[model samples]
Structures are given as C-alpha cells and as structure tokens.
Target chain A: MIDHIDSKIIALLGKDARMPNNKIAKAINVSEGTVRNRIAKLLKKNIINISLIRNVNQMDNPGIAFVGLDVEASLKDKIAMQLSKMPEVRFVSSLMGRHDLMAFVLADNATELSHILYQKIASLEGVQFTESSIGLKYFKYDYKWGRLLSEAK
Target chain B: MKNNLDNLDIQILDLLEEDGRASAKSIALKLGITEVTASKRISKIIKGDHCKVVAIADFEKCGFEFLLPMGIRVHGKQLEQVAEKISSLDAVYSVSAVSGIQDLEILCATKTLDETVELLDVTLPAIKGIKSITPAISSKVYKFQTDWAPLGND
Candidate 1:
C-alpha cells in the first residue's frame, strides 16, 4: 500500500505529470532525495506513466471513434493481434458486457473511418460484427486513477 | 530543444495536469511555495504553448455507446476544411492531423452504430478533396497517460 507521503506524491503527479522532485519533496515536506527515490520506485513498478496527451481535435484532420467488436472465440487472440497491428488502433480491451471487445481508434476523417471499418475490420477472419460510436464531447476524463488515489491534501 | 524544467516548474505542471482549474494558491500551498512564484511560472509556461490544459469527459458514463478511430486521406490542401466539418459532427471526441501521407487522425464516440455508419458514409465522403479512409475498431484501452515526465520520473 502507498503510504501517506507516497499518496500525496501520486496525487500531485496525476495532476501534473511534469512535477519536479524538489517541488514534490517540498510539497510533502520530505527531502528532495526522498521524493526522487520514491518516484523511481513507482516507475520501476509500472505504477505510473508520464507522457504527453495531445488534443486530437486541435490538429489538421482529426477523427475519433469508439468501436465494439464481436469476434469468434477461437480467433480471439488472432483477431486481437491483427487489430493491434494497425497504427490507427491506439487502445484495445476485452469487456464484460454485450460486446466482447472495446477499442479506440484515430483517423483523419469520416472517409478514413469507413475504409478501416468496411475494409480493414470487416476483412478480418474472426471479426463477426463491428459497431462504432463517434464521440461528440468529452464531459470528463479523470485519468488520475481517482478510485485508487485519494484527493486529500 | 526545450531546456529541462526545474522543481518549481514541474510542481506547477503536476497540479494543472491533474486538474486544470487548480489555483496557484492551492498549488503553492501544496508545494510550500509563495503563491506569487507559482503564478508567475504558470503564466510563463502557458505563454510558451508547450501544452494545453483543458476539460475532458468520460463518454462511456455519458451514454456514448459507439466509439471508433478513423484515418482520412486528403486530396489537395483540403485538410483544414475537412477537419472543421468533422469536428462539428456530434460524435467527434478528438482529432489529430498527423505527419504522414494519410494526413488526419480522428476519434469519435456516438450513441449508436447507425450514427457511426451514417457519419462515415454520408457526412465524410461528401467533404471534397478526400481520398481514402481506414477504420481501426478499438477493442480495448489498456492505458492512457497524458502527462509527460518531469525531470525526475526517469
């Protein structure tokens, strides 16, 4: 379990992935080296990933979509591997609901979305059916692992 | 190259990355710094435009059932026009004009499959200077990390 100080560090990092260790230490009233050590440990454990997230809409030809896919049980791994090969597919997962798989893909426009679905997705052997839903707006996106991380100062 | 940021800079970035609305005072309190210093640093970074802090939604809980990623190839210099039209669509979540032959990247989440197909078939093709499209049906999202590393994560 993350200790009190560690939790504070996590909360701060979640808010700003770019926070320096000195500030983290100062914020938590720990030594700068102590903060550094803790962060190293966290990274080694794969508890945190610090990276950039660009807003796709701000770009030139942005396209975003959500898809639910049903695949044959026998071809689950094969289909997933193939889907993962595509650059357009960023994230993929198996769900516990009506659809067996859920995914996020990036594209330039509607025409690109169609070609991928009709040609790429449909052409796959195990893909029995595919359904897509386009995102209109993002009301909230809390990647802070809010469930696991506490908000206490 | 952008010089590596210092401690104060990282602290400010961390606070905003989690919640863009966090005040400099709050960040200062958390970081044991004067509010004035925090505010100044934040102002400087925003002016630089390294990144932006904005509000994002959880579409799944918001009742968006269909979400798919699309790749669009453009004809001529029609990137700007096609992007505007696609963004105006009710289903777009995020759009990316990538560096490549394909040109644009789009993310969409909608209420139904029919809407997804209609937008792809009817709305997108109508945009002139369009060439080809590729759709990657996302089956799962294992992880998403928006915040880039400070000098310390490494």
Candidate 2:
C-alpha cells in the first residue's frame, strides 16, 4: 500500500514523470534519499515500469486494430502461438467471460488488415471465431493506477 | 520554427509524453541542458499549459473488451455539436473531425459487442446531420501511444 508520502511522490510524478528526485523531495518535504528508496521499491515490486510510448499510427505501416477471439477449448494454446508468430499481431490476451482472447494488430491499410485476417488469422487451426474494433483518437491514457486510489488527487 | 517550443523544449515534451516518470537528470542529459535548467523548465511548462503526464494503460486491463474506430460523415453546423455529444458518452474515448467523406472519427471501448452496437443503433443515428458511420474494429494494437521520438537526424 502507498503511504501518504508515497502518494505525494506518485502525485508529483504523475504531473511530471521526468521530475528529478531532489525536486520531488523538495516538493514533498522529504529527503532525496527517501524518494530514491521509494522509487526503487516501487520498481522492484512491479508497481512502476518505464517504457517507450511510440505512436504506432505514425509508423511505416500505421493501421492498428483490436480483434477479440472466441477460441475452441481444445486449441487455445495452438491458436495463441500461431497468432503470436505473425508479424502484424503486436498484442494478444486470453480473456474471460465474453471473449476468450483479444489481440492488437498493425497493418498498412484496409487491404493489409484484410490479408492479416483472411489469409493468416482465418487459416490458423482450431480458431473458433473473431471480432474486432479500431481506435480513432486518444483522450486519456493514465499510466498511474495508483492515482485512481487517491480519491482524484 | 517560431513556435513557443525550442528544440530542448520539444525534446523534454517528447520524453515526458513517452514515459512521464523520466528523471530530470536523464531528461537534461538527453537534451544537453543542465539538470537545474530542465527542472525549472518542466515546472514552467506544466504551469503554463496545465498539462499533466500520465501512463497510457492497456485497454484490456481496464475491462474494456471492445475497441472500435467509427467514421461518421455529417452535414452542416450540427457536425461539431453531434461530435461533442458522442465524445461525451461514457464508452466513447476520443473523437476527431477529419477530411473527405467522413467528417468525424470516434474511438470507443465497451464491455460487449452488443453494447457497442446498441450505441450505434440507439444513440448515434439520433444525432443531427449524421450521414453515415463505418466501423473499423481493431483486431490487435501494435502501438498507439502519442509520444513522438526525439531528434536523431542522420
């Protein structure tokens, strides 16, 4: 659980992910060392991860879409391995309740999307069915889940 | 360019947008600015623009089962109003007014396929001046974050 100080650190960091620890410490009235220790712990425990946020849409082939699959109980793993191998499929998830699996794919255009689906996904063995949706714009992409816990801080 | 952003400013913006938790020292080193200067500039930038850095989560993790990009072509002054209404819907994430046959593009996330269709059938068509809507469902997401890369000209 995040303590109040930890929460402050997170709050400040959320506002400026690139803020220096010393600046963060100064803002929260904590020592720089304390801020560093907390950050290290957060990272070690998988509370925070640093990664590149690339705009896939602006890339060489930028068409992105999400496909939800209803997999046959017998061939879940096989279908997953095959989809993962496809260069166009960037993300795949095994879900619960409604859809069995969800995936995120990128292609050049409508023609490319059709090829990935009809040629590749449709040909894979034991794949029961698939449904898809594409994203148009982005409004809020909150990386800090901890902020949701702080009563809108 | 004559915009408010200098080269270093753009670099800082790029780094923060990609990973909001980047340290000032690291950002400064990347932009060749002093850490103190970077820290001061970040504070100024946020204050000036009222922008906050955040993580872009995985849509699936947030219980959003469907991601649909819908293109809607509309007529007249009602375009902006109709787009605003659709964008405000709980399931609707983002809306854009584009060129050509489609004047508006909406990104939506929902729990079930039925829910998404219901919005299309019930809420969307009711909006004024709406000519048509075409849906492009994302089968997979390769990358969607808006963090533009820093300069590395060859």
> Model-by-model lDDT, in order?
0.61, 0.61
lDDT of 1 at B86: 71
lDDT of model 2, residue A63: 54
DockQ of 1: 0.08
Q: How do the residues A2-80 of candidate 1 rate in per-residue lDDT, one tens digit apiece?
A: 5677667766876565566788788889999998898776655545544334445344554555666799988877777
Cα-based lDDT at residue A152, candidate 1: 12
Model 2, position B86, has a per-residue lDDT of 78
In candidate 2, position A110 carries an lDDT of: 69
Q: A-chain TM-score in candidate 1?
A: 0.85
Superposed Cα deviation of residue A39, candidate 1 (Å): 0.5
Per-residue CA lDDT of model 1 for B1-154, tens digit only, reads: 1244576786677677665646788888999989999889877764443554432223443345665656677777887787777767756755556544446656667667788788778877887877887665444544333332111111
- Taking chain B only, the TM-score of every model is 0.68, 0.71
lDDT string for model 2 (A53-150, tens) is 33333345445556667888888766876776776776554554336665656676767887897778867777778765554543333333311111
